[model samples]
Target: MTRKPSGQRGPVDHERRDQIIAAAHEHFRLYGYKKTTVADLAKAIGLSTAYLYKFFESKKAIGEAICSLCHDTLLSDIQAIVKDNITPSEKLRKIFQSLAHNGAELFLHDRKMHDIVASAIEEKWHAAIAFDQELSSIIRNLLLEGRERGEFERKTPIDETCRAIVLSLQPIRHPALLEYNLETLDNDATMIANLVLRSLAP
Candidate 1:
């Protein structure tokens, strides 16, 4: 939210903010995130650029909001997998496979939306930061559960192991790198998960 100098209008209208984001998502899909402008979004949504700024500080902020929404949807899918009544090892494998599958799907099929996320990640937007942190927590929790159940080794520090696992998956998980390894992404994801599981075995 932006600060009003003095005597602004009514409260920060969330309805209007949502309207802007909805319009932006469509326009961005059509025009690509790099080419779309804030003025273009405002004109499409029947709002003034200045008015839009009241809800979002800048064009990137609007993108961040959309990115966050997308991340939430993806996170929901991950959380579902985490909660499934399956072995921790299976959960770990499925999680990595899902991440690779989704990343490839977005990059190969939804290139426009993928660009928005690529920008967010490359720019280190708050949406990307928050998503990464939440994802790390999820992975850490899964590791802890596996260790508690005697499915994984407890000798290594869990934090270090979690960090290594995430780093190992970056090539498949990252948008920009997804294209380069599409041919072998699935195999690589499986291999990485297997290696991690083997390392974690009690």
Candidate 2:
């Protein structure tokens, strides 16, 4: 319980709420959001369903909370990378490389993450669509910047081209994008980064 702005006592445990969200992340990451029930979440956190309901009424809500945490972190990372004085195309490469090279875990783990998101809600839910828009926007910015820097053709429409580039990179997160036995996923990411840089360069 806590004191409200109105001076009456209210009840909300923000810290515990985050703990539950963390537990939800682990559960969803393992069993996926679809297969993970509220009961599972409650059990994982050592709480009853009734208590879990007090925090998050549904599994979808918990899933959204987990996705929000992940998406925010990635978005923040992208923003920081873009803060450098690099050209737009360079920035785009840096953004992707950071995810693929620096954060390979994010790409590989996305297999389970994708399943969770797809199961928890519609593909266009805020968390999913927001990321799509954020990437598209980044690509659009880079396209416009590339045209000015002579790094790309001026005829390319900013939004469409960016979306295409973003979609193309999705295969990197796919389980079958390349054979893991032949080369490590890290090597594949490097190959992909080089391929995109060379192929997309003017």
Candidate 1 lDDT over residue span 109-184, tens digit each: 8788899999999999888888899889998999999989999999999899999888877988899887899999
Please report the candidate that would top lDDT against the real structure. 1
What is each predicted model's overall lDDT from 0 to 1? Answer: 0.85, 0.64
- Model 1 clashing residue pairs (backbone): none
TM-score of 2: 0.71
Q: What is the lDDT of candidate 2?
A: 0.64
Q: Provide TM-scores for the models.
A: 0.91, 0.71
lDDT of 2 by residue, 147-172 (tens): 88888766656666776777666644
Kindly report which residue pairs in candidate 2 clash with one another: none
